[model samples]
Target: MKAVNEQEIRASFANCSKGEAKRLALPRDLAEQPWDDLDFLGWRDPGAPDRGYLVTERGGEVVGVALRLSARQRGHLHRGMCSLCLTTHPGSGVSLMTARRAGQAGRDSNSVGVYVCTDLACPLYVRGKKLPDLGGRLEETLTVEEQIDRTRAKLSAFLDKVLA
Candidate 1:
């Protein structure tokens, strides 16, 4: 990630309220982040372990969210098919991760599912990591960009539901 200022950070949140956006936690060492390897930025909060955040660039604009990591499942290894990236594994280490509802004040959803790389890197996906022959598993002819777009839109919709 770049050394983003408050304004630059705020601009990433397109649909969230100002109050909620103001409370988002930023990376401590933004300048040192491996931006070139990330498809987007995502993290688990050290202070509130269940809390998390995600920021992605779609259509040349930044879209960010304050998320939460809900209940954990033990020994559940990641197959490396990113729910967010729609990219399958390439023998690289990756994992399936989940997040809690950000603005969820009520209503029964304890968690949301996400497939994150074991390395917590999005740049690899963004730059298009080489995948081990998915072989008709993805079920479509769309390009990588289209897959990313669909995943992002799904995430945005999920956030809206949480806030609403």
Candidate 2:
């Protein structure tokens, strides 16, 4: 992924109003992010832990979506898998992240939700850059490149649902 500035990130949002995008916080550590290792930029708002955001290059354009953690949904105690990277996590490592639909539907309060890594670190997990102590992620036959592609596809599909 390419390094992006605050203005670019704010303008890339597809599921929120201009005002909301403007108010949304950009990661304070942009200068230190591992850009080459990222498929997308994702982070939970420091000021608002329930609020999350994701931005990526899709179909030749930069696109972004706003996400909210469904705090009412509890994580499984034994094992859980992130729908995006397919990484297994124990306990509270996975959570239901919801995204408001784009355009008028979003304004009407319609949204979509999926189980994802609590910290939105699917890229790192898939690459084995970061490992949790849970030891639940099963060994896979798929190669690293295949896993990356799969992760990107899953995220794109989710974005498609939001845009729809």
Candidate 3:
């Protein structure tokens, strides 16, 4: 994925109002991020842990979405899996991240949710650049490239739901 600037990131949001996107916090270290290794840029708000953001390229256009963590607290005893990267994490390593639907559906208070890594680092986990909190990532028959593609597909599907 190509590195994007703050203006592109803010303007790419499809599911939130422009004012909201303008006000939301962006990652401070955009220049330091591993852009070459990312399929999408995702981060939780430091000032508001429950708020998160994702930005990526879709059909040659940069697109973004705002996410909110579910109200339910996760237990730290059992293992959980990220729906996007298929990485197995122990306890609170995964979360139910949700996004409001775009346009009228969002106005109607509709949203979609997916189980993802709590820190939203799917690309790193898929590439072995990052590891789960408790156990190591699950071994898979697919190559790293294949896993990355799979993760992108899953995320695209989720985005499709939101954009629809």
Comparing 1 and 3 by TM-score, which wins? 3
The TM-score between candidate 2 and the true structure equals: 0.94
lDDT by residue (1-164, candidate 2, tens digit) is 99898999999999888999999988999889998899999999999989999999998888999999987655466677899998878877788899999999998999999899988888888898988557445589999999899999999889889999
Best by TM-score: 3
| Whole-model alpha-carbon lDDT for candidate 1 | 0.55
Superposing every Cα of model 3 onto the true structure, what RMSD results?
0.8
TM-score of each: 0.53, 0.94, 0.97
Clashes of each: 10, 0, 0
In candidate 2, position 127 carries an lDDT of 90
How do these models rank on lDDT, best leading?
A: 3, 2, 1
Error of 1 at 91 (Å): 17
Tens-digit per-residue lDDT, 1-164, candidate 3: 89999999999999999999999999999988999999999999999989999999999999999999987876778888899998888887888999999999999999999999989999999998997778567778889999999999999999999999
Give the distance in Å from residue 157's predicted Cα in candidate 2 to where it truly belongs: 0.8
Best candidate per lDDT, number?
A: 3
Q: Write the per-residue lDDT of candidate 1 for residues 1-164, one digit (tens) a residue.
A: 33345566766664356776787667777776676555567766676755666776555566676554435433333345655555555443335454444454432445555654444444445445633343112666877667656755766665565445
Pairwise TM-score winner, candidates 2 and 3: 3
From the highest TM-score down, the ranking of the candidates is 3, 2, 1
Where model 2 places Cα greater than 4 Å from the true spot, the runs are 73-76, 133-136
lDDT of each: 0.55, 0.88, 0.93
